[model samples]
Target chain A: MYSSVSKGFALLVLVLMNCIMFSAKAANGITVSTEINFSAQPQQCVTLHQGRDCFATILIQWQRPTSQTICLFHVNKKQATSKKQLMCWPESKAGQANIEFESSDNLTYQLRTQLDDRLLAETEIIVSWLHKNTRRRRWRLF
Target chain B: MFTKPINPNIINRLFIYSIVAIAFFIAATTHASPEEQSLTTHGNTPITKDAFEWQFMLDMALVNSPVMLTDVEQTELWDYVQLGLLFDISYKGFFLRTNSRRSSTILGGEELGYQITVQKDWQLDVILKAYIEGFDPIEILDDQNKDIPELVGLNNREYTSGIALRYSRYFENAIFYIDIASARASENEQGHSATGIIIDSFYSYLIPYRNWDIYLGAGLTYYEKALMDYYIGINADEVSSARPFHIADSTFRAQLEVYAQYPLSQSWSFNAGITQSFYSNSIKRSPIIDKNKLTQLMVGVLYVF
Candidate 1:
């Protein structure tokens, strides 16, 4: 009986030690994981004229490990506004998320992602306006 | 009636004399005007210009004043040394700028620095900075008041030197600017060094009604360490020893700041700013000693000639 009692106490101590070790490991664990993948389209060319507006759709793809939610945020220079959305579990897929932005002269766009207020990734895009066809022809002749 | 008829010539003579007397009185009054008009002709004209076309301003203000150190959490009370020089050329919107400062005892040792920038309607500014800093050790001997024997001296010496490039645009009453630059620094004894890239952009709006201007800005900084041994790599046998310094080996920093400037006169202005930094890597992981995550407050005066 005494042997069984001692064995039970030893098992309890072992479980406690394991619990402490796991917590410590979690606290100090430094892992480098790629959190977000972002891509945009036309995927190539966008054209607009000075004093006119144009639009393009941006597609973003993000992957989070295990159980985590990703928040995507975007800003446009020409429109001077920001948009954000949440990707929850089960519905989040490995595909392009569509976004739209208006183009002005020398328009630019920046996008970033966050998970629970922690920034994961960021990138920038630029768009320029094209001159009219007649103007282009005149310049070519000159 | 008969006596009066005989005196018509005399009456005409009296009327003529009266007319001459009136004309003399009018001429005398006009010629002898008040002394006020006479003084105006001889007195000095308004002093529109001075002998020296350009003036130099030398100013010294005790920075510990409450107005200068408004935010307690961001600002620490320490001895501050500031020096500045500005030259205004004859051409409009052309100037030369030089500024330097030294602040002591906040983190330990001193930060000595100088920068030169050119001023135009739009500023194309270039800045250079050099600093020698020493970190205080955590454990000090009671008798000697020196660092503990186990600590390495390489952890104390941090020398940083860098150049910055900035472009600015000025509006009628406001200014906007963007800056991008890179810096490299190393410690000789440890063979440890870091190279960093920084990009900052900001806008300042003039609030003329209160004689002050407000500024808002955001900045991003990236740092990568070329040598890891100086930061966190430990000797094979010293596994249990704690690394007293926490340096971010490779990290990203983002910050937002607000600032205000008030002009005291044409030659003197007061400036202040509060900045908060967000870190990607832990501050305790840095190789440098006693570095922590905190907001910073800076306030100083600008003297323009």
Candidate 2:
């Protein structure tokens, strides 16, 4: 069982590395981003004392290989006719929103780069929830 | 001006208000956690996410220091390489991590154990740790109190296992650490067993300037008498002919460490750290002690994935 698991792990790592490499290259030329992150998280209490008076947050951040203007929009099935643009060209690098369950129900998000009013590249993005955000622990030595 | 009478009730109410206010202040100033990051995917192939993370790291350094924490007098500098593997599997807020540290020395500094992380952000952890304690042979009665024999038969190294509680927090540029452990002798066939509690606290500050990072840290450590005696104390049976029955009490120690790193790129960095330690009087008064200060230096490169 362990052997098979190890093999699977190796394969997964190879794929992840390839994806990262491709992403880097794509960001440089005509690709959408060098790196990007779109996520949803429960609003966390930033204090020692904990409480459940928390909501949810949607955040998006991206980097360009070169300075190119991109536009991003957030829409939801509940408001099918509304096109809530989160960012415009140049300023569309990052955006965040505090939301509720109804706000995220069937939400649609997309990123596109434009050149002289012409769309050059476009991609739909899906934001997934992470169990928690991890902070790097300090290294210790004996 | 007329002086008002002291009202204890107002002071009491004011104190409660201040505490609540401070709690709110602390909560407001805290930073967002990054332990679990939500991922955004392009309309392409689905990315597979794993539940476990495994990393292999090697730390090689040149150090001229004592053979052991208690053996402070050894001034000979030796170069050593330390290789380590860190395997962490985390889900939700719970995690289990197994660490392997391998080194080359007569007094092995290798450790193999698993630590259960019950909580990360609040900085609480329960750990089981095992390590080798090294020692040097005691020389003949150099500072004779009267009539004492030269040391003959003595143990050189021992293994110890312990349950430790660790608390850590990284606030802005400084990190705080506190670890307390209760340990007992393990795998000792010579009827040499000891148990005691150990407490240590460290405060370290990080300074990042462009591509260079510097760190300065200070810590305090306390050891129970049982633990100190087993390492530095002399036994009754071993105190004959030319040796005297000597004992060591609980000891305290202080340390200062300075480290710096330069990131050459995203995957590679060069780092160096030096540390100095001062021993307590209880340990200094031990019969075999020759030096009170111990210094260590390490320089190496690190790679990350």
Best by lDDT: 2
Steric clash pairs (candidate 1): B246-B284, B246-B285, B246-B286, B247-B285, B247-B286, B247-B287, B248-B286
List, residue by residue over A1-142, the lDDT tens digit for candidate 1.
1122343465456445545544432221211136544344433223322233445565555554534444555545456554444333343534346666554433222223334456554433333222211110000000
Best by TM-score: 2
Expressed as tens digits, the lDDT of each residue in A8-112 for candidate 2 is 465456446545644643421222433444333321211100111222344444454455566666555457686565666564555445433223233445555
**Candidate 2 docking class:** incorrect
Query: Candidate 2's residue-wise lDDT over B22-122, tens digit each?
Result: 44334423522323333334654332222333333344555444433332232223214333322334333333333212232111222222333323333
Candidate 1 lDDT, B35-149, residue by residue in tens: 2121111334321111112223343433321111001111322223333232211111121221212221111111111212223355455644332222222211222234434
Cand. 2 TM to true fold: 0.52
Instruction: Report the Cα lDDT for candidate 2.
Output: 0.47
- Candidate 2 Cα deviation (angstroms), residue B107: 13
Error of 2 at B191 (Å): 0.8
lDDT of 1 at B214: 62
lDDT of each: 0.37, 0.47
